[model samples]
Target: MSSSNHGLARKLGGWQLWGIAVGLVISGEYFGWSYGWAQAGTLGFLLSSIFVAIMYTAFIFSFTELTTAIPHAGGPFAYARRAFGPVGGFIAGFATLCEFVFAPPAIALAIGAYLNVQFPELSAKWIACGAYIVFMALNIVGVSVAAAFELVVTLLAIFELLLFMGVVSPGFSWDNFTHHGWAGSDSFSLSAVGGMFAAIPFAIWFFLAIEGAAMAAEEAKDPSRTIPRAYVAGILTLVALAMGVMIMAGGAGDWSKLANINDPLPQAMKLIVGSNSGWLHMLVWLGLLGLIASFHGIIMGYSRQIFALARAGYLPPMLAVIHPRFKTPHRAIIVGGMIGIAAIFSDDLIQIAGQPLTANIVTLSVFGAIVMYIVSMLALFQLRRSEPALARPFSAPAYPLLPGLALACAVICLIAMIWYNQLLALIFAGSLAVAYAYYLLTHRQRAAAASDVLLEGNDAARLKPAVARSK
Candidate 1:
């Protein structure tokens, strides 16, 4: 098939790119970050959050370099391939695939849990499955339409978070937030430091998947311009919102009560306004927009990844076939949805170390994400040395400093998560091993034979018009 026939349509502009970037992660604002409270009390998790925020700030700033220079849907996968060839591409691609594929089920379950707040009789698992089906359909219809929907829901999600902060201001109390804040102790001790590191996965949940926006680079109308604007703005917005919302929730009431549950905001609201308040009701309803936004956006991310990998013969080539009418990766979209739904069903079937199923899934996803981040930063350094003339519309500002900072933080998070969740880490490692073995046996030769043009991204000649316009 021709590239024209299979290529994703360029329909996303800067604002739309912002939507995907934020929408891909806005769910963290809603439910998952509270899990950090369980691992580290408010003070300890706060420390963890700050650490993660620093990592993300460095990662996104440096990552924008790869997105603009390559502008491929494969994202970190493409960058690694360009830097180190097929083997590196497969590792990054597999890690990214794990991150994107595993995330939505967790988000979908959150969506089901939110709706179950109003309708207590419904099964959250089935509802999660239904969500996977509905949003996957929406994603399959068209990227422009999906992106338009993403923008609206992401805006609403952002507004709802800000409103939560405003609504809780009356009851906010620093004394309440600070009391027993450091892992249930008034002051930090050596043991509390353990909690801080153990909380790294959930702290990461605060801004996870923001980099998924880079997967949409192929569809971005002007990647070199839109990606930097979208990414830089997205990171800053998420950091402010994450800290603000966490602080507001902690100060509202018994912070311990909000730690273990999935619906922290509504529970925090109830602590102040009682469960019957209209404000609480509004949050329950409007909060779905945040979960839905991330759920839907992640479906878009994983599908594009699957499409990219399959197109390169890393998976079945049929997944690369774009829908003629919709011009979307319809097959990839459906396949990923099936995987997510299956994961939702497996929640009851699998138990790891008595941990809640959602927490386990979150840890797994974070592991994949951290690995991909490490690989991507290394790719950035390698590309700098190898592809010296690659048209970089946005360079990593501090070169080795910023990218190295990102790499160090990612490695720390990976180590922390592995220490805290050894069983899950083993599972993730084993899966990666199995997948790589399969690739070597079945697809490595084809990947080796594929053209290096996409891998090298020596597209200076093609980027001439865009560069001229920029100049």
Candidate 2:
């Protein structure tokens, strides 16, 4: 419990962690996944989604074992560090930072787009920047307060999705879904298969960053029990909601029409009820809740990841400081918020080769996610062999089989994205190279400082004693 003194209040339980998990991902249900439809059409995207869903289901089950056993704010970073040493840990932590940090600006832009539907005069960029300021302030106040707000917004967002399904269900048509089934191909061919491969990132959008719930382990009450339950409940809820929203939207009208748009759900709602109808209006207002839930939740996620890395000497120590009164990672949260806001304003629509900037950012984020997934799965197997007596409150069901499959699926997704987004892939690789080089130059000094702090009865004492007792 050295982390308790690190200043984060462990007020979250199963329900609150569930909210953070679902909230972190619910925006996917509202927007980004439709870009898959743009790539492969309805049938193509649906097939891609099925494979991604299988990957996520397997990964989540295995990931919970690490979460419960390690129960650190670093999440995958901690797992990799324990199993692979500093190098592997930095890779996992950096990838996680990329995944959580890059995601929010996209969601914030979507929020701006949603509001633009109502008030056409206000600029989306300004609106998004303003949102970051407001939510970041809310987050800096306290973990319990921020999580409670997340739960309320997450519930409202979930209700809005269900309400959307109900209204659009009656209008669903089989022909509309199949109209441009394989990106307008006459039938399934080699070209169609290639498109499906290209669509993997967007299909992943449906469940991307759901693992963020694990980042809250340090803030969760009885994380060994609460983390697994929240993860299980959260993924199930997302699977059901993702499938429902995709099917309803694709079947309601020409699926192609909604593809690649920033606000697919609202557009789909307009198909059933006219553009200016009350239903459409309701969706625009309530839909902001979905974007807010994710925008808020991911801010919480990235701050914790930054805090963990800083605390472990992988980043600037300043980021590790917790607020005295608020007891939150205020510095970490502000740093992440600043980065996201910068991304929002840099609205470079230029395509890297053929991929748009937004798609490129999303692709970069997925690249990070896939790397983390691969490393974490590898860490799980390594830990199993290396620490046979490790206290695991919850074991991954089916053991090697599930973790193995998760690894394979993640590897495939990473390959697909590289093939489709070569330039963005290179950019991501370059960023990692720079970060790793920096780590190599400074890690020894930081580690020495960290060791000194640990010996002085600080947060590291909490971790050292636990491991010693276990040995």
Candidate 1, RMSD to the unseen true structure:
4.7
- Cα lDDT for residue 462, model 2? 58
Reference-based TM-score of each model: 0.96, 0.95
Task: Give the C-alpha lDDT of model 2.
Answer: 0.88
Tens digits of per-residue lDDT, candidate 2, 1-471, equal: 254436567799888999999999999999989888878888888899999999999999999999998888888998888887778889999999999999998888888999999999999989999999999999999999999999999999999999999999989998888886997764888878988999999989899999999889888999989898999999999999999999999998978889878899989978888897899999999999998999999999999999988887789878888998888999999999999888887776445766555676778789999999999999999989977888899999998999999999999999999988888899899999999898988755455434322112124565556444543
Residue range 1-471, candidate 1, lDDT tens digits: 236546888899999999999999999999988888887899999999999999999999999999999888888988998888778999999999989998898998998899999999999998898998899999989999999999999999999999999999999999989889988899889878999999999999999999999999999989999999999999999999999999999999899999877889999999999988999999999999999999999999999999888877788878888998999999999999988888999987999989878888888899989999999999999999988987899999988899999999999999898898889999999999999888888653343333436664665356445434543
Total colliding residue pairs, candidate 2: 0
| Model 1 local distance difference test score | 0.90
